[model samples]
Target chain A: MLFDNTDFDYEISFLKIPGSDFNKEIRDSKFLSPEEGFLRGNLMKDEYVPYKNLTYFKLTPQNEQETLLLKLMAYSFTINDLNLYLDLNPKDQQTYELFKKYVKEKNRLEEMYSEKYGPMTITETQGSNYNWIMDPWPWDNTGGSMYV
Target chain B: MFKYVKHLNYPINIKKKDLKMAKYLLTQFGGANGELAASLRYFSQKFSMPDEKGKSLLNDIATEELGHCEMICTMVHQLTENATIEELKAAGLGSMYTEHGKGIYPSDSFGNPFTVTYFAVTGDVLADLSEDMAAEQKARATYENLINMTDDQDVIGILLFLRQREIVHFNRFKELYDYYKKKGY
Candidate 1:
C-alpha cells in the first residue's frame, strides 16, 4: 500500500534544510508516531507534558470501521500539528513536505473511510444516498462503538 | 468558511454515565477558562496580529478550540443524557435542569452563564499572546482538576488528551511570542 500505518518515517533526505539554525531546530524537535501523537494529543515529543505522572488512555478498536477511523484521526492530528508548526516556521521546507505527506494520506484515508462507511463530511458522500444524517452521530451513545 | 466534519478530533464514548462528572465537565464548556473562551479569545485576537504567522496561528488555533468546544459539549451530553430527575437533583444539577432540562448550556461548575467577560482581546500582540499562554495554562489546570474528580478511564483519557493539547498550544503561543520579541514587534 502507498500509505500504511508505518509510513510515519518522515526522515526523508530529499527535503533539504534551508539553514543551519532552522536545521538544528528541526533536529531538536523530535516527532512521535501518529498513533502515539493521537493518543497523547501532541505530535512533538518535547511538548507532550503529562499531568501528574498520569498516562493517557489506550484506544482499542473493536472493528474495521473503528480501526480505519482511528487511522484518520491520527493522520488528521499529525497534519494539524504540522500546520501549526508551519504557520510559525513557514520557511521550514522539510516540515512543510512532511505536512503535505500527512495531508495526502489523511485525505486518502478520509475518502476510503467515507466510501466504506458513510460520509464524514457532506461533500464526501458517496453514491446517491444522503447518508450525512446517518445514525450514531459522534455524540450519540451508540455512535462511538469503538470507544467502549 | 468552515465545513462540518462528523468525526470528533478524538472519539468520546463514555459507556458509564456520571451526572456529577457531567456537571463538573460543563465548566470546561462554559467556565472562565473553558474552550468557548479560548476560541473567542484567539478569534478576536487574530485580527490585530503583527504578521501572517501570528494571524494564521491564532486563526487556526481558534478553529481548533471550536472543535474542542464541541467535544466538551458532546461529553457533557453523553454523561448526563440518561440521568433521571432525582439523579440530576442529587448531582446538584437540579437548578440547572430547571434552566436547561438536560440540554447542554454554557456555564461554569457554579452554573454561572458564560459571558464575554471571561476573555479579552487587547489589540497589542505581546499582551494578547501572553494572555493566550496564560489561558492555556489555566485550561490545562482545569482539565487536571476535572480528571481528579472522575475515576472513569474513558473520561480520564479524553481529559488527558485535551490537557495535552493545552500544553502544545502554550508552546506554540510562546514560540510566536518569542519570535515577535526577537523581531522587536
Candidate 2:
C-alpha cells in the first residue's frame, strides 16, 4: 500500500485536519465505556487517504547506494510489523513462519545494503565537529512511503 | 538546545474513523504498559533520581511517552472516521460507542476502561527505571500481539514504528540505569 510521489499530496491533506482531539479519555479515568471503546477501536483501522503533493527523487549512480539503504530501512519496518502481528495471532502458524522467514531476508538485505553504502549513521563527520545527521526525516520520502 | 535535536511528532495522518483503534490502543495508552501509566511512573520516580542526568533522562522519556499516546490516538481516529453504527458493531465496538457514540476514548481491546492502578509512581529511581524498562518490553510484546491479529499493512506499519520506539526507549532507560549505578546512586 505504498503511495508514490503522485499520491503523497493527497495523503498530506487528510493529515492536516485542525482541532482534532484523538486522545480524549473518559472523566477521571483512562477507560472508555464499552460502546465508546469499541467505536474507537474501529476508527483506528480506517483506510489511507492522500492529502498532499509529493516530490520523488531521481535515481542516480551517486544515489544508488543511498536508495538501497532507504529500501532496506523500509524492509526493516515491514519485518518488525510482521513479527509483532504474529505474536498477537498465533493461530496462523504458517503466516508466523513466513513472517519469520521475511525477517531473516530483511536482515540479510540490510547487511548487504550496509556493506555497499556504509552504515546509516545518526551522526555525521564534518571537518572537525561531529554533528547529528539530518534529512530524509520522518515526514520525508526517505522515511519511505506508507503504501508499498 | 542542540541545533540538531530532533523534534518528536506523531508521523501519520489520522482520520475521523480511526477512533475505535484508539479505544483498544488505549489499553496500552493508559493500561499497565500504556504511555499514560509509563509517564506517571517515570515522572513520579524522578524525585529520587540520583543525578541531574538521570532526572533529565526520566523527564525526556516520560515526555516522549506522551507523544506516543498522541500517536496512538491519531491512529485510532483515522481508523474510526465516518464509521456507521453497523460497522462499529461488526468491529466489536458497540460497547464503547454506547457511551461516547463515535467520540474518541481510551480503553482496552476488550472494552475494560483504564484505571489509575495501572501505573505506580514509585519514588525510587532504580525501582522506577527498572519498571520503566520492563514496561517498554511489555509494550513491545503487546505491539507484537496487535501486529499478529491484523492483516492491514498500514496498521502493521504503525505498530512496527511504535514497537521500535519501545525498544529504543528501553535502551535509553537501561543506559540511565547504568549511569545511576556507576554514580553509586
By DockQ, the best candidate is 1
Query: Residue by residue across A100-123, what tens digits does model 1's lDDT show?
Result: 877887899899989988888899
Off by over 4 Å in 1: A1-29, A144-148
Candidate 1 residue lDDT tens string, B90-144: 9898999999998898999999999999888889899999999999999999999
| Candidate 1, B-chain TM | 0.99
True contacts kept of each: 0.71, 0.01
Over the full model, what C-alpha lDDT does candidate 1 score relative to the true structure?
0.84
DockQ computed for model 2 against the true two-chain complex using alpha carbons: 0.03
User: How well does chain A score by TM in each candidate?
Assistant: 0.76, 0.40
TM-score of chain B of each: 0.99, 0.85
Q: Give per-residue CA lDDT, model 2, range B11-85, as digits (tens).
A: 353323444455567576656667777777777776777666666666666665666676666566557756888
Q: Total clashes, candidate 1?
A: 0
Q: Once model 2 is optimally superposed onto the true structure by TM-score, how far is the C-alpha of residue A50 displaced, in angstroms?
A: 28
lDDT of each: 0.84, 0.53
